[model samples]
Target: MDRQLKPNPPKRKTSMLSYWTLRYFLILCIGFTLIAAGALYWIRSTSIEKSMKTAELLGLEIAEKVTGPGNRLLIPPDIDMLVDKRIKLFNTDNYFCIMVLDNNHHLMYSRPKMTQDDVRYHLSDDLNAPRNKNYAGVTVNITDSNETLGKVWVMQSKKSLTFSTETFVIVVLLLAALILCGWFTIYWLSRKLSKPIRQVAHAAEQIRIGNYEVNLDIDTKEQEMNELVSSFRDMSIRLKQLEEWRALSLAGVTHELKTPVTSIKGLVMAVRDDIVSPQEGKEFLDIALKESQRMERMVADLLDYNAMSAGSVAVRHERIDLHLLVREIIYQWRITCEDKMPEIELEASTGTQYAIGDALRVQQIIVNLLNNGLQAMSDEQTPAFRIRLQAEGEHLSIDVRDYGTGIAPEDQPKIFERFYRGELKKRRTRGLGLGLTYSRLLAEAQDGELFLASSSPEGSIFTLRLPLWTPPDQHKREQTYRSPVNA
Candidate 1:
């Protein structure tokens, strides 16, 4: 029976693309944010530092111009006049307040109309904020040669070297918008890429439920994904075919095995019931023996077919002479069926037509073909069965031709299918329909092919082609390691 056993669906797993994409997006956002913030802070601090240095240089130059002589502090004739002139000359945009101090650090002159806040801040007992923020200032000493006259103090207001609140707010909002856009873009792309993969996974689930007809007609941009889908489709097709073959095999085995056993039982029952006389005992016993032999042959054929299907058929490939093999098979067949056998003839293309194959398997294939040929003919009244061997190009061909009622056109195509029977009159004999199938399998497993070459009312010819064997030189040992079948 062809059983449709559906397996339970597997537990759903978490989506890897969703998790990893989000995690990576977060990491990128954090990394880029830190970089942007640090760069901004550096620019602000560098600008503030440069401003403080410029203010100190300008103050020193002003103090030099007002010096009377030597290094002694000299007050300008117009105190406010000198301060205002110097402040206007040196750009005061970067400085909140600029003041001159005497040698003792006491304030002497001021510029920019110093406010209460500025005065308190410059003269405070302790600076309250981080210098890099806004409370940055610079102080330079007024000197001439080896003497200090006074000091110049430049005050940096809280608004001097940093962006205003409005500008800062706009920058932060832009950065947030960019981060959101980037995160969403990454998420969208990940979902788009994983969509096809998800479809393939769904198809796999259906296959697990014994649905070989699941449609996988999908298009993908990736070459690897396309190949994977194609391979899956082929696997489904092969599996369906194998299931059909298995079901047919089961039915055929049951019928072949039961027929012989039933015949033996019926014959024994006839004797036990005294339905036959004692004089006919030998004939009945002979019939029973033939039935047992038939059963034994059927069992052997089934095992052989199983071995071939399982890929466990051992083949020892070697150089063999096809002419010799054909002659041996024909002789054996004649000897076995001498009581009621047709005339058999062998025609060889040459004295030695060599081929590469397993000798035992090759012999089995030839025997099977011979048996089929012999079975096709009802009696010796028909023409002789001919075994022809020839070397064609790079291959050797052996044709087993029987002169009898040829196979019908409709039945020819399926004759090599396992357990497929046709031609009711020809298949009237009680036997499993595995002989031709096994013969073809054996031939293929040996790097050879067995096919129906031609068929007509006169006869049918089954041809086998194998690679011609040519003994390799010692240097070419690496090229050939007793290769297996092309199949």
Candidate 2:
């Protein structure tokens, strides 16, 4: 039995608006709730304290008025009339529960109905200063001269405290409604702001999936996002250009490979069919081998070009004698030029010519320069090439000069481009146009540089400069090899 594979689920996208809205809403709600609750609690505590103090002051005033008249042992007939009038005045506010007593603590008067406990006890006892009490009160003592007359007391009910708490709750509920309304408005605004961000994000996702044609409709009124969208559009255009260039490079490589391979195959078949004599057959075979070598060099140069382009070439530096290295390169090139009969010249400034660099890569750079010099001098009368070495300060310089048809100013700028051959030169060379480009790259990798010094009707000179490495002990007697010693 075979099991079918299941497709992966699509990723769920989150909205930036909803995410930030919920986050801010919760924070606001919690913050407002805490602030409102704390404020309500404090207000309730202060209001209760203020009300108690007001009641105490009122009671004290009533006591002063009643006891100020005289130190009478018994109540006068007009005393009841006075008490009735005072009760009517005090009870108008309706918040205070007032009661009066005589010298023996007997009930003298009360605005509302007073219980026996209310008249018999002092106002201090009713103040409810302890737990498990029913009411809170404040007392004012009544006295005539030095004699104690009675006491006047005022009390507030527990029901009134409960009412204050209920009012606070209602206020908090109303405030919460207002806060929620504001939060919703902020949420809507956030959604409006995040809409453009969402569009940009979706477009980015499409681009990530190789859909380069994704267009963004973001508002240009927002400066930052507009700039971002503009940059992204430019990047997409660049990516398309790069893709086209990649296709062109692949086609060029295939065409380049076909030419050499076709030549080799035709030459091999000609020899096999005996279409050519044995001596001519050897010549065809040699041509085939030369084509093969061309293909190999093309492949190697391509690889090197890729490495240089990617910045992956590692340079290993060591102390090298520039005089010795240049001599070896010229010696090898002299053997190669024997049959071609090119005039070669070598020049050097006297000094201890030492440099720190990769010797093999440096030698390759010289070889490439020499090859270019030879190719440039193909039609010259004497076919001459010159190599010059000089030492100045801490640098060693080598110049390769050729008396050939010089490079034009227009082609000079792009001469070192990979696979770039100008219309002025031979169409078919031993290697691709990567030689100069690779040599320049190798020179740069070794902390040296290759630049065209002059390219005019007289001749062209390519200069190579490397940083001279001087050992601590050899600072003196450095002028011996100025222009090649007598040996």
Off by over 4 Å in 2: 1-13, 68-96, 101-114, 117-136, 157-203, 211-241, 273-283, 303-315, 373-386, 391-393, 401-433, 451-462, 473-487
Q: Quantify all predictions' global Cα lDDT against the true fold.
A: 0.74, 0.74
Q: Give the per-residue lDDT digits (tens) of candidate 2, residues 1-487.
A: 8999899999996678877888888888888888777877777677668767767776776676666455743434464465456546544234446677765666766656677675434344543342225566777778777787887766666445434656767877877897888789989889877877777778788878978787776665778878987888788878876666566656666777888999999999999999999999999999999999989988998998889889888776777778887887788777888887777788876754788787778888988887787777645357788888887687889899988878888999879866666666635354557888999998888888999999987789999899888765655433322212232
Q: Candidate 1 — which pairs collide? A: none
Candidate 2 backbone collisions, by pair: 349-482, 350-481, 350-482, 350-483, 351-481
What are the RMSDs of all candidates, in order?
A: 8.2, 6.4
Q: What's the TM-score of each model vs. the native?
A: 0.72, 0.72
For model 1, the local distance difference test gives: 0.74
What is the number of backbone collisions in each predicted candidate, taken in the order shown? 0, 5
The positional error of residue 440 in candidate 2, measured at the CA in angstroms, is 4.0
